[model samples]
Target: MKKFILILSVIFLIHTASAQLYIAPGADLRLAGNVQVTLQNTDLINDGAISVPATGRFIFNGNGNNQISGASVPYFSELEIAKTGTGLLTLANDIRVAGKILFTSNLIDMGNFYIDLGSTGYLDGEDENSRITATGTGEVLSTVTLNAPSGANPGNLGAVITSSQNLGSTVIQRGHQSQVNTHGTGSSILRYYDITPSNNTGLNATLRIYYFDAEKNNLDENTFELFKSDDNVNWTNVGQSARNTSMNYTEQTGLNSFSRWTLSNAAAALPVTGLKLSGQWKNGAAWLEWITQTEYHNSHFNVERKYEDDLNFFIVGRKNSAHPGGNSNTLTTYHWLDHPLSNKGPVQYRIQQQSLDGATAYSNIIAIRPDVNSQFIVSMYPTLHVKDGIYLKTGGLQVEKMHVRIVDMSGRLMMTREMNYQSGWLKLPQLAGGAYKVSIKSGDHHWEGSFVKD
Candidate 1:
């Protein structure tokens, strides 16, 4: 018995049904060396064994639609799709590319199958007009190992990741379908990325998600926000660090982990507009006022204040919205008088307008220097604590009783109690380890501070 090998090394043009390439069950076709094979206006039907060299180039180009249907999955070293007219390359079965997939003229529709770009494989020449798309539950996948990658775009899947720590083996899957959350309300663009890394925590990663304007799916690009989901159902707004509408990408930093990510508008759009803050030194206090030109679904307003030299802002007071239940087109004004116990330097203030669905927007900050006599001073000892209690010190003006309220970074009220005005330890409810804000209120006096819970 002798073995025969069918080798194709030229431009294979099969324009008619009789000229299509078909391999029987027992036939074996082996392509070796730097073979360049082009399938022009033809279908590849392979039911036998096919071997492709690592340096071979398989080009699919024609003026009509083509399909690759066979019993065995076709593995290619390099695949190129340069279709003309009303033509596209459709995958009838799963395909694996070891080198690269070049999209030049048309789209490759992965119908219920995958186009696996192996570890070293990637995509090139993909643009808004020519790219991979799918109408079914198909995806383009790539797996690569990264160690402190900088602008590393694996498989050209469009999710560029940068980090300072090793990401280990990372798997990136690109799907072209609008993603809906668990509640089935919000939707993303036509593309989404499900990225998983071996070292998914403490990465301090920065992710830049790229997309095409054509895939916006009727979304406003100006309001795009990066959303991440652990289960691909419940999504959280990770926030956009920067965005370039002309370049078609939204970036986010300070990510501790990686997961399913997509671009979508916020659950509830930020509904405050024309926010302006103004303050003045009135008598022996700082009189802060803010106004909103229009508000929708307005829940409340949080007055945040901080010293000019401080790094974090603390919520000093929260005011209920004038039109809490409905939209307001008229101007709404809010005011707060701050009586600081000590004036270290100039103070800055801003208004955080919160919506019913937890969406928030900030107003312009206004700074004011107070020229008042110090009446009382309050400070918290052991700003960073591991225990459930912290000490508070009050000096100068004496009061019999004072009210203390604690809120988290998101302005959620955590604890509130009435404490005696003295230097003593205050017990707190068990709180998760994070940063929190503390506000103390006495007759004609207000103080604000922050602490970290370990």
Candidate 2:
């Protein structure tokens, strides 16, 4: 409070003193070792210092609409800091600052900081504190200022830091990119085990399987599910991501693969190893498998199935208990039959591995067949297995002339050819190593999705 009074007193004295140079808008001014200002202009001044007297103050009043800039190459602010080591400058209203503000001292000491004030600007660094605070619905964005060493490592595509309330530590560094797809349409995931929990129960924890690329943004769209376990093997697909774009996951590509499963209870899993579930499913029953090559928490696990076509994986059957595991080397397996599937055409099947904490994990889809089915007979002839030019063929579909385009993951069109094939097969090209989209366009029928050349 005393400092504030003294600052105000100085302003009162400056307004009552005999000013040398008056700085208003559009006036030209100059200064050497010492010069005064009562009024000045908006344009810059040639190389010179406009220093006020040791006991006096320099007031730069732009009246809120003019600029007071400095001249000279890489020119600094005209009113430098600590000019006399005792002089002070009071600016009225908000002023724009450009260029480096040099302290000039071994270390700047004794100053105050203010904002939006021109007549009495804040004394910077006087409090020995500096901060970057945002106002008025403003957001402060974080960045990676450290650059990877060139040649040492040009760049890497993965999470540099990941933390949560699930595992032991709050940070984990993954790989080159689990998300890298032969065709860009596929998704990637990186799992962590260390986090800070909201409660003692593990079910309340978050599972952040993240992807940090323009290609990995789909994790934001797709549903994130928490597959549970007592033993790490045989996980059950328990829940979904609340923030998914398309909660109705008809299309797998847009689902939020980054899942943060909140365990409903507190279940210790320090003894488990095989903690992941494969999403691939078949017929009415999807696959539920875990690779608990290590174990500690030796709880029994069950495979449950659900159908989004109607309801979720109602309980199907339960599996028995397993050995409390360790990470050294242990692998476990548990499988069960799924029941009450969608009677309609094709119903989705997902395995939810449940833990004591009420945590869950949904296995990949295993398209279940109703006892009878037709194999895709999907024979890519002349055999796409070989590098020989790969092409799309719908000549037998009785479809008319159409345009089929193949695009790489980055959404770049790779191969596009007009197809007039009315009978057997459509000629295509064997694309470079990676994923491609074979989109068939005919009138209103347009198809686009992910495809692998091999």
Candidate 3:
């Protein structure tokens, strides 16, 4: 154990030594006044963070994260940092640069370097001017214990990040890096990229915004503003975040913005989960038809019902879901029994769409006036306004021998035909060019419709 401890101490000393850079007699480092690095190697591996000798001024020139991986490059005794537009050094792997990690582009690959403030010693990445870019393959650990910044300590900030990785799996897991809005724009400026639903309907999303105020650790909350857009260009703020008050919020309402949820009603919501939202819908009373492009095995959507006078909703139904290992799936139609809805005047319904992972989404508001399918029937067979001479032959069910009657808007039967109980065609008699309704009926089967015989 003592040997191991000694080895660990030596390693720590080496790490500290790597950044104690100094300027050499003849070397060029750009950007900062001068940087002194000690190590220079072209064959460095990426197993862990490497160190650069901090000695003099030098410039690692290239665009974005560029590096010179060759043998014949001249070696500089002391390194330099240049501000030639974007003369930046990005560690493809972790690396250490002792001295001051200062530059016009105040971005330091945190995996490689740490700040050890000595007397008159201070490390800063903020010029309050340059933009910082954090790097990572999956999750980059840039552990930074900021001595904190002055002026605008912990301030609210907003960000809009897009994912176009080749792997197509850009998972922004929670605990990898800390975020702060050093910009201090403090007007609650909204910022976020757009996300369309699977069928371009609506997204079952979980909204999470992290903030680091006063330059301390990041702060989280349960409430946040949620918005959605049909096109990426235009957006509509769904509503204010109303979840975990202090640190989190979940859309316990099981909904984000849908095609028609906005402008519906403000009171139709539940307590927030953590300022985040998620949902998926599978079963309900009435059979609904729509296309779903993406599918998550998360919790299937809910079948919620609201009775007359009682503005509150209660879950009355549920449906199982498939596992979420694929990118997309579709459910042509979703049906619900809806026995929970009492015959009271106007009852409401909406799907509580949830993901297998607990994310939530919702459907459009659909209302049913008790016994609509039975009591308040609609006529279809001989629909008026249909083109002239268009024969009506009901295909699916037994329509051959049914009582078919055409009627005027004032409930006047102009023509009648006894359709056979099998497949047969119904020809209409010649009439003046006008509109009329058609009604078809059989034993216990009655249907009416409108038609246009021009």
Scored by lDDT, the top model is: 1
Off by over 4 Å in 2: 1-298, 307-309, 325-334, 337-344, 356-454
- Of candidate 3, the 10-residue stretch with the lowest lDDT total is 260-269
Candidate 3 at 226: error in angstroms? 11
Positional deviation of residue 321's Cα in model 2 after best superposition, in angstroms: 5.3
Model 3: how far is 393 from its true place, Å? Answer: 2.6
Each model's TM-score, in the order given? Answer: 0.58, 0.25, 0.29
Per-residue accuracy of model 2 over 1-454 as CA lDDT, tens digit each: 5334533443454444342222323322333344433332122222323323333333333222222333322112323333333323332222322212222221111112212211122223321122212111111111122211111100111122222322221211222222211112122232211212222232332232322223222344343443343332323344444433332121111212222211210122233334444443356444455444433333445555544234565556666446433122345665554544322323354444444444444444554433322211112244334354544433223345767676788889777787674324544465677665556666644434444555
Clashes of each: 0, 94, 88
Better of 1 and 2 by TM-score: 1
Off by over 4 Å in 1: 1-13, 267-454
Q: Best-fitting candidate, measured by TM-score? A: 1
lDDT of each: 0.80, 0.34, 0.36
The local distance difference test score of model 3 is 0.36
Clashing pairs in 1: none
lDDT of 2 at 411: 83
Error of 1 at 39 (Å): 1.0
The alpha-carbon root-mean-square deviation between model 1 and the true structure, to one decimal in Å, is 16.3
